[model samples]
Target: MITATDFITIPYTSDLTQAGIAYACRSLPYTYDRMGGSHFNRLRRIVVGVAVELAFRRRLAEEKVPHDNLGSTPFTDPDRYDIAIGGRRCDIKSFMLTRRSLIRHVSREPQALLGADALVPSDQIVSDHLNDEDLYIFAFITALTTPNQRSLDRALKADQPIYLIHPLPKEWAHPSRWIPLGTLALKCDTSHAVTLELGGQNESRAFMAEEIVLEPRKRAAAESDFYALGYLHTSNPPDGIVGVHSPSVGETHLVEPIQWGNIWIYGMQIIFTGYMTRGEFRQRGNRLPAGSRVFKYSSTRTENRSLPIAELHPLSDLFTQAKKWAKRGA
Candidate 1:
């Protein structure tokens, strides 16, 4: 059983977030959601992934562990490997734990968060995913239960229990505070002019309701939590899995996306649950047919595989092993 102790939370700095967003933006033209989903959402995912890779690299250095930085961003340029340990290449896959999943885990006393799945999209599982990588590190990022900390503060101030967490992001049954421009076009009156801003850039611009069409821009003006990284300005595609919310009211609905990717680039935390190597994963991972529900985003894109968080080797074990490899190499 994986205890909470095995899960290490690394909070990132503004500089890291900025680097991640810049990398994501530059790579936006090259990389995309192979499954044919929201391109805006794809940018958010890439940002979160790079953040995790960068943070983990810093952690390895701080611990004095031997490793090689493989440049986690610019998506497909060199290869899929993010970093290497003991000459072993690693590819990191990120998954978002739904708000409902978080709440359920919180309520269960001493509950081992065992069932969280590290997702691998089906098509990428072949050409996109480099099978030669020595290991796979699956990390999970979370969203604030409420729209923002203020919402949580208001609930606590009123002496009320916070129970408004929904199961999936961008769900119609439980609408997220963050709505993307495309989704907003569908829901809100677009005739009125709306002002928008990029994540870190100063000054805002006005968009006619009609101009707020749903699509990914080379660059989007959004209100990002990191200030440096900025916000994810896109349509919040309604789905049963992970979602990004609209921007806030004071920020003119410039809600930072709480989805796995958006949060970190916009200054959110991610947890390192555990890891498994490619050979072992290929041997043990459960094969899910195309369109199987996996975590926040449904893997409707193609057939994919998944492994439970509980089944992964503890990060401590990985670190300990890395230390041994360093000694041998020395």
Candidate 2:
């Protein structure tokens, strides 16, 4: 249950329920003009999360497994959960769009709770409770979307929701090994607090939550960090590509290939022909022909290529280079 005023605050918490509620309160009734893009996205995520939880509860019940919705708890408190076929303490995460599973993202921040390493300097510690836990079962519910925001906007307005659900990131490194599930539950010991583990490879060390604080060091200076957008040869691939385009009538189309479309960059496969949407082509006015709204161009994968500029063959190399430079805000 999200309140109206919650929209004003951008809540960033590791907790699933809180984040979902905050996102929904801030982002629903999404209109292109109303603004609050982050909030809208958050709402979508939260909705998906709820669906996952319900489904998990139902399945576990059928199997006579015991489980609780930790997400349904209060904002300030950390909800403890357990998954069981017969009231056992099994750890699991629920997903709505695809298969049943969870993917937990762990990175060291300045300070946080529940990490083996101290979250240095800062007063708070943000540890991923579910960092490495075995589960009774895991699942995912993937909600797919139209390539660009505009199409998605139209679809949402029409009240048609779309999403894709699957097991792993197709074709990339360790496909099965890379599960894109959200954090569902962390298995804890006697007390409600999460247990912290430590180990480089084989052996293991352990730490209590109260014993440590972890912090992050400032990033080392670098000359430049170049972001290169990669594209597959074909229009429709298992992992779709996302490009930025403006839909205004006179605006030029600045169709830029995304490095990783829709966040999942690993092992996305695309065929030989490049895919360009009608709205996207319209945005790059001069570059794309007026009547010829959609453009599909493909390029051969070269041995040592710089960027995916070859795909935009019609345009002059200089123009393409200029577009790339402009994108970098240079």
| Best model number under lDDT | 1
Q: What are the per-residue Cα lDDT tens digits for candidate 1 across 10-97?
A: 7646666556655664444345455565544565566666777778888888888888876544432534466888888878777645
Cα lDDT, all candidates: 0.52, 0.24
Task: At residue 112, give the lDDT of candidate 1.
Answer: 44
What would the TM-scores of all predictions be?
A: 0.59, 0.26
Error of 2 at 238 (Å): 35
> Residue-wise lDDT of candidate 2 within 140-218, one digit each (tens)?
3233434455654565576552332111112211222223212111121111221111101111111111111111221
Show where candidate 2 strays beyond 4 Å.
Answer: 1-37, 66-71, 76-91, 94-136, 146-148, 156-330
Q: What's model 2's TM-score?
A: 0.26
Candidate 1 has an lDDT of 0.52
How many clashes (backbone N, Cα, C below 3 Å) per candidate? Answer: 23, 52
For residue 306, what is the lDDT in candidate 1?
Answer: 80
